[model samples]
Target: MGGGQQYPTTCFNTVIKTVVLAGLLAQKPFKHIAGFTNSLLKCYAPDLHTFYSETMDHIHRWNPNLRCNFSATVSVFAAATFNFRPQTITFPHLDFANLAWGWCAITALGDFDPNKGGHLILWDLKLIICFPPGSMILIPSALICHSNTSIGSHEKRFSFTQYTPAGIFQFVDNRFKSEKEVNSTEMSAEERAARVEARKIRWAEGLKMYRKCPSALP
Candidate 1:
């Protein structure tokens, strides 16, 4: 993904999110990207092949439709396991599902550097993730937000971030609505007072780390 893509608004906590992102980002290259597991003599039965097989199996279980989007089909494999708030309102185009462990092939393993290419960011209280490939992490479905930085055009980045049963909601639109409403109208005296109360509520609601987007990135 690039700069234009964004993730959903989350109600999930930060520490748990940090743990998940760090786990995936810290995976050993070979285990993170299956192709590295193939020794010279074992080239025929490469990790890529095994990973694909496993991914297909997991997809079948997670999505009964067996549907694969154009973008999703092109990237290497990866899987995220989490539970979502079924009762909360969701974006219209986003998908959610449970995934089996060891799914998806390595898309871009050991190929990224912090400075060279755009990085993966799991944004919540702030930008909390930078995935390096092959390591697996679990995040809360309802709270984690993720997106990648822009990469060079000539360079190849085969990573894919997917949510099964996708297209059920559109997350960006919701964020836009909230952001616009908060920015557009001028606040009346009473409204301004109420806004302060709202802010206080957010602070009391364990959103102490609630943050504004970075000027350089957003």
Candidate 2:
């Protein structure tokens, strides 16, 4: 998040955005994993899905060799994670880093009885859903506080999650420039007011892009 335009950005682990144009990139075998997730997004939230897909395309156009094209379609998410390393129940929290109106995909895995434990808790909805193994669900995690129940000590539970951070969108919307670059520039009062107004409109503009689920995945 601290990187400047035309520079590589990373979080040491789970995220690495580079603009290096040199070297041959090896084929990512997990393209199918990403592909499947993208399909889920398309099925439930077509408009939001398109937004992410187009954003990736825009990224490629912004930097012809930014090293972000891990898959042909760029899939959907900027990042994916596995929660299987050590089974633990996630505490209720909002994924404030993700785009507030966009979705985060979640899939349950491992051996755990849904009736006994490992239910998804949507705090705002006041619902504790039995998340079946291998079932996938999408939610606006940035807007919702959610978590899950702890599994039995003898049982195992894992989760897969996909999301793109709001910073990535901010970076793109700022024309690939970092916030510091924009803020440090000298501007007239009118220009400053315009920028503030633009910021104010972003949330409302984004809300317009949200869509209801078309139908259940067949």
Candidate 3:
């Protein structure tokens, strides 16, 4: 999803988003959630856990107020955004605004036949995953093309999503400067080159964090 896309803002959406965020950030299950998320990272994209943890920690430390504006309370990652989807099939799309190497956490909710409906389609991965209620998946949304198959008309399907945007981290690292502001700054050729080199190194280091592990998900 684009960062600028208008999310549903009705009371129901607000309440559900709040409840899910609260659970992720405060409930006892949060520990399990963190473990499960890390386990998934270890299995599917092992290089990302450190980058994810460090980015989240940085946001929490220096940008504690940076959170989803749509959410009523603090979210799990300070730079993360919250989205709620219910009973609707999402069209195939890349979450381009999210960090390309960072994981997006999605928790499925509501009653539905896993074999028949609410299947997550990872087009790039060539997998159709049966997403049952109360289960979660962590994926690099910006790097994967994904969508969902329709549910039966009588069935219910809901999902809560949490993602951190690359721009947010960039802003934090740039001392809270917006891209435009950063671009407008006058810098010596050496300074600009140094900055670019630093970014390249950071990106490479982030990718190196992933190590191949046995696949855990079917």
Candidate of highest TM-score: 2
Give the per-residue lDDT digits (tens) of candidate 3, residues 1-218. Answer: 12432221112348776687656655555445545655666567655655555655665566455443222223333333333445856899998877767778877777889899888999988999988888888787899999988888888787656666777667666775666677789999999999889988886776765666556445
- Cα lDDT for residue 81, candidate 3: 34
lDDT of 3 at 134: 80
TM-score of each: 0.28, 0.81, 0.71
Instruction: Report backbone clashes per prediction.
Output: 16, 0, 3
Report the C-alpha lDDT of model 2 over 147-185, residue by residue, as the tens digit: 999888888887778788887787777777777777888
Q: How close to the true structure is residue 99 of candidate 3, measured as C-alpha lDDT?
A: 75
- Candidate 1 per-residue lDDT over residues 83-123, each given as its tens digit: 22221112212122322221222133334454655464556
Model 2 scores worst on lDDT over the 10 consecutive residues at 17-26
Predictions: Cα RMSD each: 18.4, 4.9, 5.9
Report lDDT per candidate: 0.36, 0.73, 0.66
Which lDDT value does model 2 have at 41?
75
* Candidate that beats the other on TM-score, 2 or 3, i.e. the better one: 2
Question: Which runs in model 3 stand beyond 4 Å of their true positions?
Answer: 1-35, 42-47, 63-76, 79-86, 199-203, 212-218
Off-target runs (Cα >4 Å) in candidate 2 are 2-33, 68-74, 212-218
State residue 214's C-alpha deviation in candidate 1, in Å.
Answer: 37
